[model samples]
Target: GDSVTQTEGLVTVTEGLPVKLNCTYQTTYLTIAFFWYVQYLNEAPQVLLKSSTDNKRTEHQGFHATLHKSSSSFHLQKSSAQLSDSALYYCALSASNVGDNSKLIWGLGTSLVVNP
Candidate 1:
């Protein structure tokens, strides 16, 4: 079975600094779509980034990340990170052949907190 993995647990940081959250995945199929979903304190989870093509960087909002097929990883990184970047980050995946029924499997949420 395919699966997504991320930097589990809580991540605390200051308002002005760099932050990087790890994301990795495993799939028996060669082609799969990967996504990064972010959830605020009370809002629904929204798609932050996605990748269908291999070895391409996908970014959204103030964050940017790349999907590496060879490494089976898609790690998020941001320079001079902000307080608002603090939220719950989830790594997800869907197989290319699974069609619309293809459901997204998510990793354990990563909680990021920034101090002012």
Candidate 2:
């Protein structure tokens, strides 16, 4: 079984300040992919970043995440936080080798609040 963990339940950052959303995982599965999904107030969750190769960084929009297999982490980072960056972020793990139906384990999600 695989599981994702988002340490911060809530993160607050001033506009223009750097922000990091810590994400870690524990799993025995070999072939896996990590993803960071963001959901705005009233919108469906959208894939922010995805990483399958170990030690490679994935970027989308204004956010970036590096998947470190050695540390089992894929922390999301943004150079500068903006007001529109406020959202609920979820860390998920997917094991593609499990038959034709890949299972995804999702974290409890962290809420990011950007202030002006």
Candidate 3:
């Protein structure tokens, strides 16, 4: 089965700092979409990024990341990270089409905590 995995445990840092959330995956299907979702405290998870094209970088909000099929990874990175960046991040994957019965597979979740 296809699956995604994110950096485990909480990442704690200062208000103004750089942050990177590691994400890796494995899939038996050749064509699949990778996604990054962010869940703020009580809010529902929102799509932060999505990629179906191989080797192309995708970004959303204040984060940027690229999908590397050869490496089987899609790492999220941000410059001068902020306190607002604190949230639960999840790496996910879905098959090309929704009609294809491609349910989204999610990571275990990574918590980003920022301090002043």
Candidate 4:
């Protein structure tokens, strides 16, 4: 079975500091893609980054993550934390080019809080 894991249940940072959110995944199938999704309070979840290619960085909205197949990790990072960046983050896995199933295998999600 394919699965995603996010070790942090909650994270807090001062604005202007850096932050990292750990994500790891396991999959039995080949050709899988990974995604990072962000959802602010009362807002729908939206994709922040995605990568199918190992070791390549994917970034959006000031957040970035790199998928490393060798390590089965896709940890998210930001150079600087902003108060507006506080949100819920999820790491997810999707089967690519080999399945009719469109649903993503998602982690429990990390709640990020940035303070002034």
Best by TM-score: 2
lDDT of 1 by residue, 1-116 (tens): 77888898998888878899999988776457888889999999999998888777777877888888889898988877788888899988876553444567789979999889
If scored against the real structure, what TM-score would every candidate get?
0.90, 0.93, 0.90, 0.92
What C-alpha lDDT do the candidate models reach, one value each?
0.84, 0.91, 0.86, 0.89
- Ranked candidates (TM-score, high to low): 2, 4, 3, 1
- Per-residue CA lDDT of candidate 4, range 1-116, in tens? 67888966899999999999999988777778888989999999998898899888888888888998899999999999999999999988986546555557999999999999
- For model 3, how does the per-residue alpha-carbon lDDT over 57-110 read when each residue is reduced to its tens digit? 777777889988889999998877888899999999886553566677889999
Alpha-carbon RMSD, candidate 1: 1.8
Q: Name the regions of candidate 2 deviating beyond 4 angstroms.
A: 98-101
Clashing pairs in 3: none
Off by over 4 Å in 1: 98-101
Span of 10 residues, lowest total lDDT, candidate 1: 95-104
